[model samples]
Every structure is written in structure tokens, then in C-alpha cells.
Target: MIQYLWFDLGYTLVSTNREDVYQKVLERFDVFRNREEIAIAYHRADKLFMREYPGVLGKDSRAFFPWYIGTLNYFLRLSLPIEEVLEVQRDVARECPIQWKAFDGAKMTLRHLRSLGYRLGLISNWDESARAVLARNGLDEELDEIVISSEVGIEKPNPDIFRMALSQANVTASESLYIGDNYYDDVVGCQKVGMHCLLINAYGNRGVEELSYHPIITGIQDVAAYLGHPRVQLEINR
Candidate 1:
């Protein structure tokens, strides 16, 4: 029996609207890079940041802020001094809490699952700011546990974080279901720990095709259908 359902945060239960945040920050410095350019730079920055910083973020916001500024400066190639870039980064960080929000069906779906006797938890690659965001959106009360990468000192796709989550949930991997939007981190990460998993493709964004072993939902609301619950007869319309 499925005793627990763990979810990924950023694109799973919550929507970051990162592009808006990026745009707002960039505008402060009069940087007019097009969306495509920003996307390319941000992607490059992410790879480098993950490789270098790993799980240092979230443990202490003070340390990560500089790393974030450096990453942005490197990608944007703004040639600004460290101080100038740091100022921009600080501003961006301050605005992030207001930017993150829960998706439309996230709370309702979690509540529904809880009512059906499934314990709910969260395992995300985020930091302490996640606490405030969850609390602000009232999602904190819906979760039984929250394991963050910064707090746990391990990031997803590493398998160790997944193991940590399972340990916290007090359930074996086989008896839990992990859901997230990221293909590698959420799907492959949980699969590494032998957990059943699902991917949420909210925007209908396409990149990775579904494998025979991979089950997917177009939105969080469709989770009940995937669970085969008697009362919630929704379908995966995608």
C-alpha cells in the first residue's frame, strides 16, 4: 500500500514564475537582453552553479546570494564590478519570496490525498525561503514532512536526498510515490531509490518523451486518477 506521497517544490506544487523575476531584476540594471539570450545564459549559469556550489544554497542565504550574483554576472557578461552585481543580486533575492506561489490545484489535491489516508511530504531542491513561501500560501500545514536540499546537504538526482526523504517519512521506497516536474531530478532521483514516481507536465512543455516505465500527469489535480481512487475519477487528458 502507498503510505506516503512526496512532491517536488519548484515546478511541482509551486510555480516560480522565474522569467518574471529575472526580467524584473535585469530591468533594474537596464539590461535589455532578449528572453532567448537570458534563457541561454541562465541555463549555462545553472549548470555551472550546480557543479560548483552543489548543496551550499538554502543552508545559508548569505552565502548563496554571492554565488547567485556571480552566476548571473557570468551569464549576462555584464562586465560590472562585483559590488554592482551584488547589489542587483540582493534586490532579486529580496523579491523572490513574493514571486513563488502554489499552483492552482496543489493544495486541494494534497488535501484530497490526505483525506484518503495518504501521508504527504515534500522533497525539494530549495532553501530556507521555501518555509516562508509554503507558510504564506498555507501549504505548510498540508505537509507531514519537508526535506530540503540545503538542509539535508544533498541534492536530488544524487539518490542520497531521496534516501533521506524515505528515512524521514518512515516508509520504505517501494511504499511511497514521488511526484515532480523535473525529468532527471524528480523522476530518476526517486527511481534510484526504488520508489514509484510521476511527472507533472503543467505547461504541456515537451522535451523528454514518456518511457514505458514512466507515468505522467498533466497537472497536480490528475494525481487522484493516477492513484486509482474510487471517488476521484479524473483522467490524464494529455
Candidate 2:
């Protein structure tokens, strides 16, 4: 029986769909921009950084904020100070809070799982302030454990993060399951360390087509029923 559950943050617990976040940023900046246009701009900025900051980006491929700011600066063609870029980062984080809301059925599933006495933990490739986002969304108090790449200096697919979560959860890898969106990062990741896993794919990920091993969920609610929890039938009033 599974006793512990580790979850991916982006696209799992929270929805960081670039288009959704871009719309909020445009609104906050008063730019009067189209969401598609803004997303393209975001891509341009990141493409520049990947070509430029090879060293930094090489070491940390999941440097989300850096890629975000770099892409913004490059696309906007503005030469703002890194500190100013950071201010914009903080502003986007705070003002665009809705971009990071729990998925349609996530909060209720988490609450139900918690009620069932299952140990829930979060593992994400996020910065030091990830805890703050989790706190803002009220997911912090609900989780029994957390492992962030920025804090631990190691990232997912590395297994060290899972090891740490194992230490905190006091369970064996075989006794736990990890749920994430990314194919390589979440599914292959936790599995590399011998943990059973699930991939939460809302978009019907095509990359998983060849993978023969893991179960996939289109929504977090599916996981509750898969867990065999009869209380999983409760509706999420959101």
C-alpha cells in the first residue's frame, strides 16, 4: 500500500500555464497586450538567455526566474538593472497570483488525501521563495513535507531530493509515489530512485505515448480514486 505521495508544483498543484501568466502580467503592466504575443515575447527572451548564459543556464536548466527575467529583458529590449528585473519578478509573482492557483480539482484532492491520513509532500524545481508561493496558496500548511531544488541545491531526476523527502516522510521509496507533469523530470525522475510514480498530464501528453510503465492522470482528482479512498467523491467547491 502506498503511504507517501510526492507532488510536482508547477502544472501539478499549481497551474503556471504561460499564457495564463502572460495575460496577468500584461494586465499588471498596463501593456494592453495579447496573450499569444506576450508568450512569443517570453520565448524570445528565454532563447536569448539559453544562447548567452550557457554557464549559469548550463548548471541550472530550471532557473525559472532567471530565464523569465532574461527573456523579458531581451524581448522588451530594455536594459533594466538586474535588481530592477528582480523587482519585476517579485511584482509578477505577487500581482499575477492567480496564475499559480490550484488546478480545477487539486485542492479538494489534497484535502481529501490528507483526511485519509496519507502523507503528502511537494518536490519542485523552484527558487528559495517557493515556500512563499505555497504559503500564499495555503498549500504549505497542508503538506507534511517539502523539498525545493533551490534550497537543497539539487534538482529533480537527481534522486537526492527524493532521498531527502524519504528521510522526512520516514518511508521507503517503494512505499511512496510521486506525481508530476513532466515526462523525464517527474515520471522518469522519481522512478529512477525506485519510487512508484504518476504523471499528471492535463494536455494529454504525447511524450508519454511510448512509456509503458506508469499510470497517468488528466486531473488530480483521478489520483484520489486511484488511491482507493472512498471519500474521493467529494466535490471541489471552487
What Cα-based lDDT does every candidate model obtain? 0.74, 0.70
Global CA lDDT of candidate 1, please?
A: 0.74
> Cα RMSD (Å) per model?
5.8, 6.3
Query: Residue 75's C-alpha lDDT in candidate 1?
Result: 73
Off by over 4 Å in 1: 19-98, 203-205, 210-213, 230-238
Candidate 2 lDDT, 1-238, residue by residue in tens: 7988888887678865666664655554555556656655654553344334422432444566655665675565544556554666557767555356666656778888888878899988887768887887888888989999888888877878888889888999989988876666667678788998887755453434555656878767777777876746656574
Candidate 1: deviation at residue 49, Å?
12
Clashes of 1: 0
lDDT of 1 at 96: 71
At residue 52, what lDDT does model 1 achieve? Answer: 61
Candidate 1's TM-score reads: 0.66
